[model samples]
Target: MLTMKNVTKVFRTEMVETHALRELTLEVKSGEFVAVTGPSGSGKTTFLNIAGLLDDFTGGEYRLDGVEVRQLGDRARSKLRNEKIGFVFQSFNLIPDLNLFDNVDVPLRYRGFTRGERRQRIERALERVGLASRIRHFPAELSGGQQQRVAIARAIAGDPKLLLADEPTGNLDSQMAREVMQLLEELNAGGTVVVIVTHDPEIAARAQRNVHIVDGVASHLDRGPALVSPALRTA
Candidate 1:
């Protein structure tokens, strides 16, 4: 569903040129749960930003769901990103003042959905994250994991075709991390293409495939069949 060929990102100044990504090539298919693991300065964030259409690459080609992103204008890119990609950040980027329902409703509002539709999407998104009853609760009132769930809810409310998560469980305890991972797994099973960028080995191990980046390029990729939890195979 996502393809990148010879992707290069360069940051140039009068004094120096920094190459954040160098000919990075990778593909993520529909319904795949892929973990991107890399050390600092390895260009993981750069790749994620480009993949999500948040930033443009200096060179190379990127096709998202068959559309070549390089040819699109900013407005078109923004529209496609809002329509096709969902993001979960390491820091739950929830609005501090908005309650859970409103936080989830913010993006839907931008989509120009009717009030009823926005409300329905918010509730259903929260329900999927197991936070329906806490719709009125504020972010400060919830645990770290709960807050992350709210972030995930906000992301998935649009029913995006691709889900991009960066350090999704970085702030939670082990149990909460497991819970959040399980939720992501469930979503992937339901057919959303999931690409997670993380540093935690345990977290990387849970994904169906692993893509390791180094020196701004994909250095390793697991070529085996999907590696889902055995319990999920029967479910």
Candidate 2:
């Protein structure tokens, strides 16, 4: 679960100041699938960075998984982020020379897992993403969708409590996008907390909840069909 109360982020320059997030208050419960949608220059990216602990905010409070993040030291924040959060970026962010197995292993190594533990985690993560067979393939050898799946596998290898995806399907075709979305949905169904930031309306609509950001604030929040559907449990 994540909570942001009156969170504000300001970027200062020599002559101008930019507000990336303006007193944004948002909460995501455990095992929920949420989508954040907005146009370019909106605070979507800023919010994601803050939520992922990749960037610092200028004001207000952020409690991730019940720990107050605002006052945590950089070392503490980094450890928490590495242990609890997973990120999937639009760019894939894979190393060119590394095979899929190595790509997923990199983060596990950083987490200081033993070699055997890393191997097991990597294998399971790849299997979860349906990429176990392609673990030896390089990023360049896979299709855009497959590459994205590998990226997702890398993120989930550590069993992160929260998944943050930014423009996950930005470079893929419609079919590929749908495939990726279905994968994410399946993950959420299995109890992963997934939060996606996208500009695509169709993608946003499929999530259990949708939040619209505009001008550094959350402009609209919708519970979407999942909240009212009898078949879906309230997360």
Candidate 3:
């Protein structure tokens, strides 16, 4: 679970002060899939970074998986992040030269897993994303959807408690987006807490909850699934 209370993030320069998040309060429970929708510069990215422990908040409190994260040192935070959080970015963030297996193996390497264990985890992650056979292909050799699936594989290889995705389907076509969404749905069903920041309302409808952010504040929209598909219902 994740919780943020009255969280404020300020980016101050010599010339001006920019408030990326103002009194932002949100909570994501275990096994929940939440979609974050916001306009440009509405602080969705900042919230994601803070929630993923990629950045620190200037004020308020945040707890992740029962640990208070307000003032942890960089080393401690990085350790916790690597242990508890996974991230998928819009850009895919894959190394073009590294094959699929190697790309997914990168994070496991940092965890100090042996070659055998790393291979095991890599295989499982890719299989979950339906990309096991493409493990030897480079990023450039794959379609956008395949590359994103590899990115998701890389994120889930650690078995993270929380998965944070930013614009996961931004680059894919409708069918590919649905495929990626289905993969995420399956992951959530298996109990990995998922948070996605996206601009597409239709995609947002697939999640359990939709949160709209504006002017650095977030409000949860009390509505049912955008469509009553069986997958969305169970997810």
Candidate 4:
């Protein structure tokens, strides 16, 4: 569960003050797959940063899993983020020199998991993305879709409750994009709270709920039951 109540973010310099977000309020329930769409410069990036705990809002309240975040210190914030939120980005962000296994192993190491535990998590995450066979392959050797899968595996390696994806399919071709979306849908079906930030309508349309942002304000454009997963429909 992620909730933002009347949130505001302002960027200030000696010359001017710019408001990236203005009283933006949104809520994502657990077991929900949500898509956030907006035009360029519509505060999408700002919202993603704030939502993923990568940046702080100038005003208003943010609660993740019912814990307020505005008052948490840097270390506490990092801890909470690592334990609760997993991030996937447009660029994939894989280290070119590291193999798939090591790439996914990076964040788990930060969690201070024992060597055997990290190995277990890395293998399990890679297996989940269907990349366990390529664990020893470098990012440069794989196709774009495969690299993105590696990124997804790394994000899920921590077993996070919330998965935040920023333009996850932006760099892939249509076929690859569809594959990635299918994988995301499967993950969502398994009850991970999936929040995707994308400019593609086809991608956004797949989500059960859509939130459109303009000039820092958000509006809900809820989809129909066709988009809802079987588990959700039954629930």
Which pairs of residues clash in candidate 3, taking residues 3 or more apart in a chain or in different chains?
Answer: none
- The C-alpha TM-scores of every prediction are 0.93, 0.93, 0.94, 0.94
Cα lDDT tens digits for candidate 1, 107-218: 7877889999999999999999999999999999999999999999999999999999999998888777878888899899999999999977667777878998887878
Q: For residues 16-91, what per-residue lDDT tens digits would candidate 2 score against the true structure?
A: 9999999999999999999999999999999999999999999999999999998899889989999999899998
Report RMSD (Å) for each prediction in the order shown: 2.8, 3.8, 2.2, 3.7
Report how far off residue 125 is in candidate 1 (Å).
0.8
lDDT of 1: 0.90
| TM-score of candidate 1 against the unseen true structure | 0.93
Output the better candidate (3/4) by lDDT: 4
Could you tell me how far off, in angstroms, the CA of residue 75 lies in candidate 2 after the best superposition? 1.9
lDDT of each: 0.90, 0.89, 0.90, 0.90
Report the Cα lDDT for residue 29, model 4.
98
Residue 86 alpha-carbon offset, candidate 2, angstroms: 0.8
- Better candidate number, 1 or 4, judged by lDDT: 4
Clashing pairs in 4: none
Considering TM-score, which of the candidate structures 2 and 3 is the better prediction for this target?
3
Residue 107 in model 2: lDDT = 80
